[model samples]
Target: MLQLNGCAAGSSSLRLAKDIAENNRGARVLVACVELTIVAFRGPEEDYLHTLVGQASFGDGAGAVIVGADAGVHYPAERPLFEMVSASQTVVPGTDHVLTMRITEAGLDGHILRRELVPVAAENVERCLSDAFGQLGVGVEWNDLFWTVHPGLRAILDHIDKALRLEPGKLAASRTVLREYGNMLGATIIFVLDEQRRRMEEDGEGGEWGVMMGFGPGFTIETMVLHATSNLRKK
Candidate 1:
């Protein structure tokens, strides 16, 4: 059996990581840190904030997934909600400081979000899709099951929906996540995917398709496509 912890730093990731690592020492454990370039709201003299934008130029978060080869944990033998077909990432140079978040005594905080980022996002999203799909020799069409895009903000979702020419309800899942979880950095997309899987399991339906996407510093975007399986629907 494998246990996975998708938590951010100084929050839950550390304790979860320690518990899993100590107990499942021999399992294939993976730890990933996702850093975002967050613009701090403090009067703009913060060095850490500048370092984040000037050096890393990215907001950051972390997630860990463990797969046990010999442990007797039973993951149902149903078709996966989505088989991760392919993934692509692109970095737009010279666009640092566009988005950012910061940690403080109060808590994590950041900008109020501007509407203009939407137009910038719309122009780049298609290229991301094209590259990701092209690698797999697949073309996108309306019949695709779901569009699991990152919901950085309400405006961003509106921009992406408009740019992609998505259907009215295409981004509902993403929107719901935003309303509930705020932007969880890299973890946001994964949360949406997990929810989609949960919804299918609860409804006893499957064989769906979905796309997952995330954007980060360097003004970069990451994308992946998944094909769900009915066999995996929960009982």
Candidate 2:
């Protein structure tokens, strides 16, 4: 058990899982991410539109996954709940001013919901995604990967979709989560990842290519490409 907590902490968890799997034999790790953002930002001052947008879109969520070194034996639950290909984080040159949160007597206060956040997020996401895909060593395009983006804001998600020109509804999981659950900060990505697994299970779909993205303070952009452990359909 290890703690990787932050706005894009989900990406950190995946990176650790990848390192453990590749370096240590028989290593198993349980990564749990939980967010209580609503409570974290509770206060009347949150009435400002800057805070209101986030409050309206986020909710409490927690999720976990177990990762182990590959061996012959396997669980019979069809396939792994999720597989992480790679995770990487990037902080654009000097965009840190665009997104940030601070603690004050009024409780946790945030400076997000800025107009600049959407563009900065969209830009960094592209750069990070391109770099992540390069790590996969696969001839895959961004459009080929399933997206499980942390739904930071509806507008930001839309901006990414439009900026990347992703296929229509590619960010559905994030959008759906935002519509129903809002944003859970670092824990939001875990919920999106779980939602992807659930969708695949219900649809009887099996494909490895996936890209998970999360944006947070430091104007950071975190991304991971997901791969199937086995030929899911072949399994």
Candidate 3:
């Protein structure tokens, strides 16, 4: 049982599960994440704005996905949705103070340098993604691929959209999840993926290639390149 306590927990699990499945030929890994942010709620007090923002955005949620190699080899009933093509993580230097959570006498307490968060992510994301794609020996245009971004804050999504110059509706799933469920910390990314899948099926939107991004403490960025499995099956 691996325990990760941060917004990147779900992304971390997906990367680890893929590695485990690749190593063990016939093994299947279950990646599950649950967050109970409400349990850490604090009543209004000093730093009232912090309390208010946290209460307004954070919520309880759980999500799970099964990972394995050789689709339909053992479980013919199992159908794959997204294929984990590649995963990488990068931490912006000297950003330890940006987003942090700690256990306090009252409950969970966290700090976010809100103004700096969006800029840090926007400035570094292109470089980070370029490296990931470069290693795969491919050149990619931002608008040609789908995106599943961690919607930790509306501003983060807005800035990333502008930075990447992504087409409209590229982040619709992320926005929808945030609107419907707020930020459920680590579980939020999984919810975004599910919503993305639904939109692709319902609207026949998105390309065969995609990227999943998650941000958390340390100003970390977890990136996973994805391929639509349905496209592969059709070939």
> Which segments of model 1 are wrong by more than 4 Å?
1-79, 100-116, 204-207, 232-235
Question: Which numbered prediction scores highest in lDDT against the true structure?
Answer: 3
TM-score of candidate 3 on Cα atoms, chains taken together? 0.93
Per-residue lDDT of model 2, residues 79-160, tens digit only: 4555665667787778767777776566566676468888888866777777777666677766766788988788888888
Per-residue alpha-carbon lDDT of candidate 1 for residues 1-235, written as tens digits (9 for 90 to 100): 2111111221123223434545675544454545442433334345334433332322344444442333333444423245555555566665545544455563344432255456667788888777767777876673355766767767888888888788787777788877776666556665666666666677543335566677654455666666565444444
Q: What is the alpha-carbon lDDT for the whole of candidate 2?
A: 0.71
Candidate 1 — worst ten consecutive residues by lDDT sum?
A: 2-11
lDDT of 3 at 151: 93
Candidate 2 lDDT at 167 equals 84
Overall lDDT per candidate, in order of appearance: 0.55, 0.71, 0.86
User: Would you list the rank order by TM-score, best first?
Assistant: 3, 2, 1
Query: On lDDT, who's better, 1 or 3?
Result: 3
Find the 10 residues in a row with the least total lDDT in model 3.
226-235
Task: List, residue by residue over 1-235, the lDDT tens digit for candidate 3.
Answer: 5443478788888999999998998888989899988887767776544767777678899999999988889888888899998999899999989888777665677788988988998899899889889999878899988889889889989999999998888999999999999899999999999998887887677588889999888888999999888733233
**Top candidate when judged by TM-score against the true structure:** 3
Q: Alpha-carbon error at 111 in model 3, in Å?
A: 0.6
Residue 66 displacement in candidate 1 (angstroms): 4.4
Which segments of model 3 are wrong by more than 4 Å?
A: 1-4, 45-49, 231-235
Error of 3 at 168 (Å): 1.0
